[model samples]
Target: MRFIIIGAGRVGLRTARVLRQEGHEVTLVERDAEKADRARGLTFEVVDGDGSRESVLQDAGVADADAVGALTGDLNANFAACLIAKHHGCRTVMRIDEDYREEIYQQYADEVDEIVYPERLGAIGAKNALLGGSIQAIADVAQSLQIVLITITDGSPMKGYTLSEVALPSDSRILAFGKANDPLGIPLPDDSLEAGDRVAVLAEFSELTEVRQLLVGDESAAAAVAGGE
Candidate 1:
């Protein structure tokens, strides 16, 4: 696959590197002389011009690209680049900054194939690391819903129960289960929960405490893990 990425800063360059490592063709458009030189220093093909300009994107081979990632920090530039890519029938992925108002975010979200908020994703990862323990937040599905990974411990109330017998809180559901040292998979009705087992659950934010208590137990252990860091 071929990709045209707008901007050559941290996010754009890192994304280009990953795509290139996977054997995909990548070209970056960077307006800044220093950034363009930096990307070129790493043996990347960079077009030196404003990414919002259609001519600049053409130089980066947007017409032949399978996808375009508008990853510049400038919201207007990113949106313009995505609009041009969409006109060329390319899949568009636009990056949005954390400072934008919710209404503006939603308006632009409807125009692109995908929206990425790097800061939000980074925060989620940082939070997981900080809250280390038997329970970890996997993702924020929405404002009110979250996906969490829970490890069954010795004191867990559900440790001796089967998947079919465990009753979770309202609006919560078990998504996947895994035995100790094994990869997670679809939950099985006959599978029994035991110490060291891991379970992935999707629950509303209000029900997370109950889910954690039922699956992990012993809150002090989790607190100790976080405090030790």
Candidate 2:
């Protein structure tokens, strides 16, 4: 696959390198002379000009690109680049900063093939490290909902139960299940929950504690359940 990346800054350059490493051809477009020269120094094909301009993108071979990644910090520029790329029949990926509102996301989401939040992804990695080993946050489904993976431990209340026997809170639902050392897949009714097994659940923020108590019982889980009484 061939990819055209806008901006030679941190995110754009890193993405270009990864794609090149994976045997994909990558080209970079940068408005800044210094950034363009820096990319050229690393032996990458770079077009020198504004990525949002149709002529500049044409100079970067946008017509031949399989995909376009607009990863600059400027949201308007990113969106413009995506729009121009989309016009050329290329798949477009637009980068959005953390400062954007939900409405802003919704507005641009419909116009691009994909929207990427680099800062949010980094924060999710840090959050997972702080959340400990038994539980891992997969994604934020919405402002009030999250998808989490719970590893059943020996102390888990549902450790020896079957999938059909497990009951979650009203706002939560089991999404996938996997046995020890296996990959997660669609949940099966008769699949037994054993220590080391994993279950992925989507739950509202308010119901997370209840889901944790039922699926990942620990000392804190017990305390949370007791405190609610």
Candidate 3:
């Protein structure tokens, strides 16, 4: 796949590197000479220009791109770049800093394929940091659903419980489970939750608190996890 990234800052450069590592062709566009210079050393093609402009996008071969990632910090610029890319028949992904404005932008979301919130992702990171090692939110799915990976810590209420014995909230379900060294797969009735085992669960936003209680034990466990640095 050919990807055109409309920023040369941390996010764009990192995206380019990961895509290039996966053998995808990537082109990075930026307005700053220094940032463009920095991106030139990476695996992607680097173009110095204002990505919000049609001419600059044309120079970056956006018309021929299979996908475009508008990652500039400026929301308007990112939105404009995505619009141009979408018009050129490229799949567009735009990053928005403020998640609260999502509904307002949903009107234009059809023009773009995906909306990303790095700040929300950062909050997940902060949660992991504070939690120490028990539960981690892996991804935020569409609507209020989320995918989370949680470890069966010592003395957890879930420890020794069978797949069918564990009670999850109505809006939540365990998707997969595995022992410490085993490959993750759908949990079976015979499978038992043991210390150090990992489980993946899908839960709605409102049910997360109850789901956490069931998986992590109690409010004290949550407090201990949340109080960590």
Candidate 4:
């Protein structure tokens, strides 16, 4: 696939390199001379101009692009570039920094293949590191919801329970289940949870404590459940 990345800064450059490593072609568009030159130094094809401008995008071969990612820090420029890419029949991904505007941009997400908040994702990583558990956040579904992956351990409440028998919080749901070192799949009612098995679940913030208690009976999980009493 041919991808056109708007901006040649850290994220753009890294994304391009990874795509190229995955056997995809990548072209970068940068308004800054230094950044453009730097991208070129890395042996990437770069269009030296403002990516939001039609002419500049045309110079970058946007018409032939399979996908276009607007990863610059400027939201307006990213949106403009994504709009042009959409018009050219290319899949578009626009990056935004602020979490407050996630809902506002979600309206445009269907139009632009995706609207990503890189900073928010970084913070989620830090948060997962801070809260040590068998359950770690994979992604934030919304301001009040998260998608988490949990590995069942020995003595875990979930172990030995079938999908139908296990009870998660009201606002939480298991999406998939898998054995240790295996890929996750849709859980079946007859499937039994076991030690070393993993489950991915979507959970509301308020129900996180309950979800943890159901999966792993840790001290913190017990404390949280007790505190709620």
Find the candidate with the highest lDDT and give its number.
2
Q: Write the per-residue lDDT of candidate 4 for residues 1-229, one digit (tens) a residue.
A: 9999998998889899999999999999999999999999999999999999999999989889999999999988998998899999999998887877778887745657787777777767776676666767787776788888877888687789898998887888989989887899998888788888888888887888878878876634633321121
Distance from true location, Cα of 76 in model 3, Å: 1.8
Compute each candidate's TM-score over C-alphas: 0.88, 0.85, 0.90, 0.87
Q: Which residues of candidate 4, in runs, are more than 4 Å off?
A: 108-111, 219-229
Candidate 2: residue 129 lDDT (0-100): 78
Clashes of each: 0, 0, 0, 0
Whole-model Cα lDDT of every candidate shown, in order: 0.85, 0.86, 0.82, 0.83
Misplaced by over 4 Å in model 1 are 99-104, 107-109, 220-229
Model 3 TM-score, 2 decimals: 0.90
Question: For residues 115-168, could you state the per-residue lDDT of candidate 2 as single tens digits?
Answer: 888877676677667666788878877767888898999999998899999999
Worst 10 residues of 3 by lDDT: 220-229
Cα-based RMSD of candidate 4: 3.6
Clashes in model 4: which pairs? none
How many residue-pair clashes does candidate 3 contain?
0
> Counting only residues 3 or more apart in sequence or on different chains, how many pairs clash (N, Cα, C under 3 Å) in candidate 2?
0
Runs in model 3 deviating more than 4 A are 219-229
Clashing pairs in 2: none
lDDT of 3: 0.82
lDDT of 3 by residue, 1-229 (tens): 9999999887888888889889999999999998998787654578888999999999999888999999989998999998899999999999888888666677646777888877777777887777667778787775588888888877588888888999898888899999988989988887998888999998887777677778777733434322122
